[model samples]
Target: MNVCTTGCDISSIHLTCGWFSSARLINPRVFKRLRYNDCLVNNGNRLANGHTISFQYANTFRYPLSVSSVRC
Candidate 1:
Protein backbone atom coordinates (compact mmCIF):
# COMPACT_ATOMS: atom_id res chain seq x y z
CA MET A 1 0.00 0.00 0.00
CA ASN A 2 0.94 3.68 -0.29
CA VAL A 3 0.09 7.02 1.28
CA CYS A 4 0.38 10.51 -0.16
CA THR A 5 -0.13 13.70 1.76
CA THR A 6 -1.70 16.84 0.38
CA GLY A 7 0.35 18.34 -2.46
CA CYS A 8 2.43 15.21 -2.62
CA ASP A 9 3.87 14.20 -5.97
CA ILE A 10 1.97 11.07 -6.95
CA SER A 11 4.30 10.28 -9.81
CA SER A 12 7.20 9.92 -7.41
CA ILE A 13 5.56 6.99 -5.68
CA HIS A 14 6.61 3.75 -7.33
CA LEU A 15 5.05 0.38 -6.49
CA THR A 16 5.31 -3.08 -8.01
CA CYS A 17 3.16 -6.10 -7.17
CA GLY A 18 2.66 -9.65 -8.40
CA TRP A 19 -0.29 -11.59 -9.85
CA PHE A 20 -1.80 -12.56 -6.48
CA SER A 21 -0.92 -9.30 -4.81
CA SER A 22 -3.26 -6.44 -3.97
CA ALA A 23 -2.36 -2.83 -3.25
CA ARG A 24 -4.13 0.23 -1.92
CA LEU A 25 -3.36 3.82 -1.08
CA ILE A 26 -5.04 5.89 1.60
CA ASN A 27 -5.30 9.62 1.75
CA PRO A 28 -5.89 10.67 5.35
CA ARG A 29 -6.99 14.19 4.48
CA VAL A 30 -10.02 12.77 2.69
CA PHE A 31 -10.33 9.43 4.48
CA LYS A 32 -10.46 7.58 1.18
CA ARG A 33 -8.94 4.37 -0.06
CA LEU A 34 -7.68 3.98 -3.62
CA ARG A 35 -7.15 0.52 -5.11
CA TYR A 36 -4.23 -0.02 -7.46
CA ASN A 37 -4.45 -3.27 -9.36
CA ASP A 38 -2.06 -2.50 -12.20
CA CYS A 39 0.85 -3.79 -10.16
CA LEU A 40 -0.83 -6.92 -8.84
CA VAL A 41 1.24 -9.78 -10.17
CA ASN A 42 3.00 -11.21 -7.07
CA ASN A 43 1.98 -11.96 -3.44
CA GLY A 44 2.39 -11.17 0.27
CA ASN A 45 3.02 -7.44 0.01
CA ARG A 46 2.25 -4.71 2.53
CA LEU A 47 3.06 -1.05 3.09
CA ALA A 48 2.92 1.55 5.90
CA ASN A 49 3.64 5.28 6.04
CA GLY A 50 4.56 5.30 9.77
CA HIS A 51 2.05 8.07 10.47
CA THR A 52 -1.43 8.45 8.99
CA ILE A 53 -1.31 5.33 6.82
CA SER A 54 -1.61 1.71 7.99
CA PHE A 55 -3.00 -1.66 6.88
CA GLN A 56 -3.71 -5.27 7.86
CA TYR A 57 -3.63 -8.58 6.02
CA ALA A 58 -7.11 -10.12 6.19
CA ASN A 59 -6.04 -13.69 5.36
CA THR A 60 -2.96 -15.89 5.60
CA PHE A 61 -1.01 -16.95 2.53
CA ARG A 62 1.92 -19.30 1.88
CA TYR A 63 3.68 -17.38 -0.88
CA PRO A 64 6.62 -15.17 0.05
CA LEU A 65 6.89 -11.55 -1.15
CA SER A 66 8.92 -8.44 -0.49
CA VAL A 67 7.89 -4.97 0.74
CA SER A 68 9.49 -1.69 -0.26
CA SER A 69 8.78 2.07 -0.41
CA VAL A 70 10.32 5.39 -1.37
CA ARG A 71 10.00 8.71 0.48
CA CYS A 72 8.20 11.33 -1.54
Candidate 2:
Protein backbone atom coordinates (compact mmCIF):
# COMPACT_ATOMS: atom_id res chain seq x y z
CA MET A 1 0.00 0.00 0.00
CA ASN A 2 1.13 3.56 -0.78
CA VAL A 3 0.06 6.78 0.81
CA CYS A 4 0.67 10.26 -0.54
CA THR A 5 0.12 13.47 1.25
CA THR A 6 1.02 17.07 0.74
CA GLY A 7 2.14 17.74 -2.93
CA CYS A 8 1.92 14.53 -4.88
CA ASP A 9 2.07 14.14 -8.61
CA ILE A 10 1.88 10.56 -9.81
CA SER A 11 1.93 11.09 -13.55
CA SER A 12 3.40 7.72 -14.37
CA ILE A 13 3.54 4.68 -12.08
CA HIS A 14 4.51 1.15 -13.00
CA LEU A 15 3.89 -2.05 -11.05
CA THR A 16 4.94 -5.63 -11.82
CA CYS A 17 3.72 -8.59 -9.81
CA GLY A 18 4.54 -12.31 -9.78
CA TRP A 19 2.26 -13.51 -6.99
CA PHE A 20 -1.19 -12.91 -5.60
CA SER A 21 -0.73 -9.38 -4.45
CA SER A 22 -2.37 -6.02 -4.72
CA ALA A 23 -1.61 -2.33 -4.37
CA ARG A 24 -3.49 0.51 -2.81
CA LEU A 25 -3.15 4.28 -2.75
CA ILE A 26 -4.49 6.60 -0.12
CA ASN A 27 -4.90 10.31 -0.64
CA PRO A 28 -6.04 12.66 2.09
CA ARG A 29 -6.20 15.94 0.27
CA VAL A 30 -9.67 17.00 -0.59
CA PHE A 31 -9.10 19.90 -2.97
CA LYS A 32 -6.32 18.33 -4.97
CA ARG A 33 -7.08 15.59 -7.43
CA LEU A 34 -4.99 12.47 -8.05
CA ARG A 35 -3.95 11.28 -11.48
CA TYR A 36 -1.79 8.36 -12.41
CA ASN A 37 -0.96 5.74 -15.02
CA ASP A 38 -0.12 2.17 -14.09
CA CYS A 39 0.76 -1.16 -15.67
CA LEU A 40 0.14 -4.58 -14.07
CA VAL A 41 1.51 -7.95 -15.11
CA ASN A 42 0.96 -11.50 -13.91
CA ASN A 43 3.64 -13.29 -15.91
CA GLY A 44 2.56 -16.67 -17.35
CA ASN A 45 1.59 -18.50 -14.21
CA ARG A 46 -1.67 -20.37 -14.45
CA LEU A 47 -2.47 -20.17 -10.77
CA ALA A 48 -5.51 -18.44 -9.37
CA ASN A 49 -4.52 -14.83 -9.13
CA GLY A 50 -6.34 -12.09 -7.28
CA HIS A 51 -4.36 -9.05 -8.18
CA THR A 52 -5.85 -5.61 -8.17
CA ILE A 53 -5.20 -1.96 -7.45
CA SER A 54 -7.46 0.30 -5.42
CA PHE A 55 -7.64 3.96 -4.43
CA GLN A 56 -9.07 5.48 -1.31
CA TYR A 57 -9.80 9.08 -0.43
CA ALA A 58 -10.02 10.33 3.12
CA ASN A 59 -12.51 13.02 2.34
CA THR A 60 -15.75 11.69 1.03
CA PHE A 61 -17.38 15.03 0.32
CA ARG A 62 -15.78 15.44 -3.08
CA TYR A 63 -14.24 12.54 -4.94
CA PRO A 64 -11.50 13.32 -7.42
CA LEU A 65 -11.00 11.74 -10.79
CA SER A 66 -8.61 8.83 -11.25
CA VAL A 67 -7.28 7.50 -14.53
CA SER A 68 -5.38 4.25 -14.90
CA SER A 69 -4.24 1.71 -17.47
CA VAL A 70 -3.49 -1.96 -16.86
CA ARG A 71 -1.98 -4.69 -19.01
CA CYS A 72 -1.86 -8.40 -18.22
Candidate 3:
Protein backbone atom coordinates (compact mmCIF):
# COMPACT_ATOMS: atom_id res chain seq x y z
CA MET A 1 0.00 0.00 0.00
CA ASN A 2 0.91 3.67 -0.56
CA VAL A 3 -0.01 6.64 1.53
CA CYS A 4 0.71 10.40 1.40
CA THR A 5 0.50 11.97 4.80
CA THR A 6 -0.49 15.54 5.53
CA GLY A 7 2.68 17.50 4.66
CA CYS A 8 4.69 14.37 5.50
CA ASP A 9 6.80 13.11 2.65
CA ILE A 10 7.39 9.54 1.60
CA SER A 11 9.85 9.47 -1.27
CA SER A 12 9.42 5.77 -2.02
CA ILE A 13 8.61 2.44 -0.42
CA HIS A 14 9.18 -1.26 -1.08
CA LEU A 15 7.38 -4.32 0.32
CA THR A 16 7.24 -8.06 -0.37
CA CYS A 17 4.40 -10.39 0.52
CA GLY A 18 5.06 -14.09 0.93
CA TRP A 19 1.33 -14.71 1.26
CA PHE A 20 0.09 -11.24 2.12
CA SER A 21 1.54 -7.95 3.33
CA SER A 22 0.26 -4.63 4.67
CA ALA A 23 2.22 -1.55 5.73
CA ARG A 24 1.76 2.11 6.56
CA LEU A 25 3.59 5.10 8.06
CA ILE A 26 1.82 6.31 11.14
CA ASN A 27 2.88 8.03 14.35
CA PRO A 28 6.51 7.88 13.26
CA ARG A 29 6.24 4.15 13.79
CA VAL A 30 5.60 2.35 10.55
CA PHE A 31 3.41 -0.70 10.96
CA LYS A 32 3.63 -3.83 8.80
CA ARG A 33 1.76 -7.10 8.90
CA LEU A 34 1.91 -10.24 6.78
CA ARG A 35 -0.24 -13.35 6.71
CA TYR A 36 -2.05 -15.82 4.48
CA ASN A 37 -5.00 -15.18 2.13
CA ASP A 38 -7.57 -16.40 4.63
CA CYS A 39 -7.30 -13.14 6.55
CA LEU A 40 -5.00 -10.10 6.87
CA VAL A 41 -5.11 -6.73 8.54
CA ASN A 42 -2.77 -3.88 9.60
CA ASN A 43 -4.19 -2.15 12.64
CA GLY A 44 -1.35 0.07 13.74
CA ASN A 45 -1.24 3.26 15.73
CA ARG A 46 -2.59 6.30 13.94
CA LEU A 47 -0.18 9.06 13.05
CA ALA A 48 0.12 11.88 15.49
CA ASN A 49 -0.74 14.19 12.64
CA GLY A 50 -3.32 11.72 11.43
CA HIS A 51 -2.60 9.30 8.61
CA THR A 52 -2.98 8.45 4.92
CA ILE A 53 -3.56 4.74 4.36
CA SER A 54 -3.49 2.53 1.24
CA PHE A 55 -4.02 -1.18 0.46
CA GLN A 56 -3.11 -3.73 -2.22
CA TYR A 57 -3.55 -7.39 -3.15
CA ALA A 58 -1.69 -9.64 -5.59
CA ASN A 59 -3.00 -12.60 -7.57
CA THR A 60 -1.82 -15.83 -6.02
CA PHE A 61 -2.09 -17.85 -9.20
CA ARG A 62 -2.82 -15.88 -12.33
CA TYR A 63 -1.23 -12.61 -13.43
CA PRO A 64 1.08 -11.57 -10.58
CA LEU A 65 0.64 -8.06 -9.29
CA SER A 66 3.96 -6.93 -7.86
CA VAL A 67 2.64 -3.99 -5.91
CA SER A 68 -0.31 -1.69 -5.24
CA SER A 69 -0.60 1.80 -3.76
CA VAL A 70 -3.14 4.51 -2.91
CA ARG A 71 -2.86 8.22 -2.04
CA CYS A 72 -4.90 9.57 0.84
Judging by lDDT against the true structure, name the best candidate: 3
| Candidate 3, 1-72: lDDT as tens digits | 334345654322333334543242332224343333222223333322244544443444542234333122
Model 1: CA > 4 A from native: 1-12, 21-52, 62-72
lDDT of each: 0.33, 0.29, 0.35
Among all windows of 10 consecutive residues in model 3, the one with the lowest summed lDDT is 37-46
Model 1: per-residue lDDT, tens digit, 1-72? 345444443222323333333244423332222244222211222233432333333335532334334444
Candidate 2 per-residue lDDT, tens place, 1-72, comes to 123443432323333211211233433221122322223222212212233334443432443233343222
- How far in Å is the alpha carbon of 72 misplaced in model 2? 24
Order the candidate numbers by TM-score, best to worst: 1, 2, 3
For candidate 2, the TM-score is 0.23
Of models 1 and 2, which has the larger TM-score?
1
RMSD per model, one decimal: 9.4, 15.3, 10.2
